[model samples]
Target: MIPEPIPEPRDAESEAQPLDAYSQAVSAVARELTPRVASLRVRQRGREGSGSAVTFTADGFLLTNAHVVGGARGGQAAFADGTTTSFNVVGTDPLSDLAVVRADGDTPGPVTLGDSDGLVVGQLVVAVGNPLGLAGSVTAGVVSALGRSLPTRSGNAVRVIEDVIQTDAALNPGNSGGALADSRGHVVGINTAVAGIGLGLAVPINSTSRRIIGALMRDGRVRRAFLGLVANPVPVPAALRERLGQRDALRVADVVPASPAARAGLRRGDLVLTAGGVPVSQAQSLQRLMFAEAIGRPLQITVLRNGAMVDVIAEPTELDAEHA
Candidate 1:
């Protein structure tokens, strides 16, 4: 009893000390995003599924995952404010794992979308979702990594969703399509998957994703240009690196027969320096250009072949969904 000294009485200031800067930031984000995120109950072919979604537009439009509403024509959305509404699927892009839906009733104001391209590793992030059917669940974590690729398949076509954000925030099955907000409460990523116990992944909100979302909202589908080729990033020659001011270039690993790259005389072992006047260092650099606007458009490419710079013009074709 003598060893257990009397403890000092806690004051108001001491009681408030537990809410530190990190706690305050996370709490603020939860307060801001909880109302905008909704718990979804979707019905597809008589099968019921549950997930989360976030409001991203003023007129009751919400953003979610393609897999969340798979084959669902419409569903119910329940928000944290105890309001529920019916919503219809506007469009879905499996290749990007993104879907847009419109609510039939009033909803909360949309969250501010932030550019995920500006995110750095170890930055604080807040995740708001309805995990395990618990509405308005919030978790705090940091961005563990960026530029992670997630492979997606639609029918027989396969593609990689580029520049995905990886985080340590706890995500469950029902957390799919929820908002992964920054410390400032801006929606930077759409939580899409629980990769492992301590790992989660999100679809980043960037220029490329914005283009896909716009296409989904407007055209009910996304159209992409296809240049059939496989490439790997390789270090540019020291001399070329100095002259071109770039450290890496894409090395053509394989060229599909009769495709745009092959038609343009691009062959394996060619080092691609630029495409459409933009430096080509990674697959995403070229993938970002493969949109509807680029289909059937002349794409100028510069490559290093046998130590000589070669220029070639290629007309990309619309990617067929069946074979993309």
Candidate 2:
């Protein structure tokens, strides 16, 4: 058999083109976001902690994780442009792990907030933050998954921050509250946790979070409606699934004693089909309805109990921040 001829070496520039494009994308995102992200140093109850924050408003408002500035009166923020400012904590919602602050000094223009609901798996994302106390650090990665849940608690109230973005971006100790931007440099999520090596989690920027941010900015706190029930998603019965055009419903796992759910006759093992006339499929489906508007409002809920349809009216109460 004749020996195969050797193939010519591939062109170097062509070989590196893909990597160079990726580098350019990451570089552009970093340059656009670094100046808007700040290294934060906060003191709470005489204990100091450090993290990162992102400028989200033209009038010096910044957004960060609630845990970052927990019970702190104010903090110092240092930007990548060599400018430093003092910021006062506006509000903190521990259930969502989101907080807002206003800088006492000038700040860079706010980064564009993108809809995290539009992000898809495998999409390119760039993380800009002060990881390890090093300012202006940038890391690139693809979204590994979507709709992950991060459980949170405030006093006796336990909730899940839903639709969290999961990525493989390299995050570290100081990366919390940083910007997780998309390819076009829109802030899609806020880096919140390092789940493991190469696994990072972000609180998605969506309508629900927007409401929380707005409440924080205006009221210094988030007011939530309390239903007082624990639920999980479950497959809907075949007959009802076809009729409702939905595959899943929320299964009531527990109901707090004397709570609105219990008062409204909602019980464990009930499959919730709709709340306030909207289809209920996941915990978030019910959570999204538990905002300020839902408080004190009569909510009509439909459920499947013992293979029969049951309707109940629940009047949710305003969740007390101190007791929640």
Candidate 3:
């Protein structure tokens, strides 16, 4: 219960403290979410604009899906209180399906990012944003799944591994880049995209965003690490499973020449049966491994090439920074 307002405390020192506890609770939660409940507006050439939900950044930045706000010919943003303002694209990461947008003049307060790594399946979570242009909307759900692989708009698939929290929380189209929070309302993920039945995907902003956002704020771009190779993971069909004696493997689709994979002697058509002793079933299993690994550290890779198993180690390198 909120502490009753004892008619102005007699002590002058005590009078300095505000005593509306109930109001404090409501306002605190609102203050935590209001800045992140951003609106994304885009204008393409002469075409009349469009908008979506976004999140405000810690340092006057706005975050959203790259596709929604990155390539806009003209764009703007709206925060709480109907404050509308112009914006510019700082940088875009199509691979991760994330982008950093910036507004000039002044920006509202930012949201505190929560740890996505600690997100537990079935734990309480909240999706706070303006859905379908409705301002200040909050939807609640429990974490659904942890490791998941989501397809990307750039045709390169995105695999969220290790605490890639899933929730039945309804995330509509406009909810992209809005805050996905824990019960305490700390942001755990950015509402990026939605897919089949209760399965919405988001990019974990914990460590990745820490790096990207810093770079974007300073230079309008992020220097990201990339390993130029493609692995096609095919699940063993239920009927065919018995013959293989194992669940799955990554069938190497393509390898970019001079890439870490190529430089390390990894070949196309190799089946990645294991990664660091973890049995690989799908492409995401490997992608997840990559994301979890240190940027410059060599990874122990196990593959089946022409029915023979091979082991090799390769380090991940940075992706193009300016092109974003």
List the global CA lDDT of all models: 0.86, 0.87, 0.64
lDDT of 3 by residue, 105-124 (tens): 46677776777767777876
Candidate 2: where are CA atoms >4 Å away?
A: 1-18, 153-159, 228-240, 247-271, 281-284, 303-313, 322-324
* Tens-digit lDDT track of model 2 for 104-211: 999999999999878888999999997535778889999997766665555665555555788999887899999999999999999998878999999989888998
The TM-scores, one per candidate, come to: 0.80, 0.80, 0.65
Residue pairs with backbone atoms closer than 3 Å in model 1 (clashes): none
How many steric overlaps are in each model, in order? 0, 0, 4
Best-to-worst order by lDDT is 2, 1, 3
Q: lDDT tens digits, residues 148-234, model 1?
A: 656555565655555578899998779999999999999999999887899999998988889999999999888878787677667
Q: At residue 60, what lDDT does model 2 achieve?
A: 97
Question: Cα deviation of 252 in candidate 3 (Å)?
Answer: 8.8
State candidate 1's TM-score: 0.80
Report how far off residue 96 is in candidate 3 (Å). 1.7
Cα RMSD to the true fold for all candidates:
4.4, 5.9, 9.7
